[model samples]
Target: MSVAVIGMIAGMALGFAGYFGGFGAFLLVAALGAVGFVVGRFLEGDLDPGEFFRPRDDRRR
Candidate 1:
């Protein structure tokens, strides 16, 4: 249930995907995992959509 354990399992699955389906599969799986992690964080309220898209203030202006 921990993040590290989830990541390890994902890594292992992607490794198998690469072995059977080649580099393209590996990249696809990795991309999917990245997207899933982001979505999960957002849904869990660990990530804020506003903060992600907020503009930075120029202190010198």
Candidate 2:
């Protein structure tokens, strides 16, 4: 879902910059969605969102 949103946004940006029509934007979004999903799955092991934004938990009992 997130990937789809990102692709759509990116496609729109590209369309605006390069004057691509609706069909071009849709194609760009589809291509990006395919590539992004494949790459994300391959690199999933190397990513951790919590480590980037969440604070560490320290507790002693």
Candidate 3:
């Protein structure tokens, strides 16, 4: 499926969770999804942990 479709599904799931389980559930699901994505990228050798914490030149004044 396309990214938009996948995002729409995820958004619907999260909306239901928030409606039935409250704000905490929504936050928990979002955080878990983020962590899972990072882990998957790491496992696939596409993520560099060090780069995440390093300062970027674009951020400097």
Candidate 4:
């Protein structure tokens, strides 16, 4: 399936979880989904573990 479809499905899942469960459950699902996506990218060799720990140059004077 396309990314859009997958995204839609995930949104629906989150909505159902929130409706049937509660706000806490919605947050739980969203957080877990993010972690799962990160892990999947790692496993697929698309993301480097080092990048997560690496610092950025967002600081300014």
lDDT tens digits by residue: candidate 2, 1-61? 6968876887666666456556676677667767776668658866555555665664445
Clashes of 3: 0
> Over the stretch 1-61, how does candidate 1's per-residue lDDT look in tens digits?
8989998899898999899999999999999989998999999999998887666873554
lDDT of 2 at 54: 61
Tens digit of per-residue lDDT, candidate 3, span 1-61: 8989978988998898899999999999888888987898999999998888888764766
TM-score of candidate 4 against the unseen true structure: 0.87
How far is 25's C-alpha from truth in model 2 (Å)?
0.6
Count of clashes, each model: 0, 0, 0, 0
Q: Sort the candidates on lDDT, descending order.
A: 4, 1, 3, 2
lDDT for predicted candidate 1 compared with the true structure? 0.91
Clashing pairs in 4: none
| Residue lDDT tens for model 4, 18-55 | 99999999999999999998999999999998887766
Tell me the TM-score of model 3: 0.73
TM-score winner between 2 and 4, please give it: 4
Provide the lDDT at 60 for model 4: 59
**TM-score of every candidate:** 0.81, 0.39, 0.73, 0.87
| Candidate with better TM-score, 3 vs 4 | 4
Number of the predicted model whose lDDT against the real structure is largest: 4
Q: Which residue pairs overlap in candidate 3's backbone?
A: none
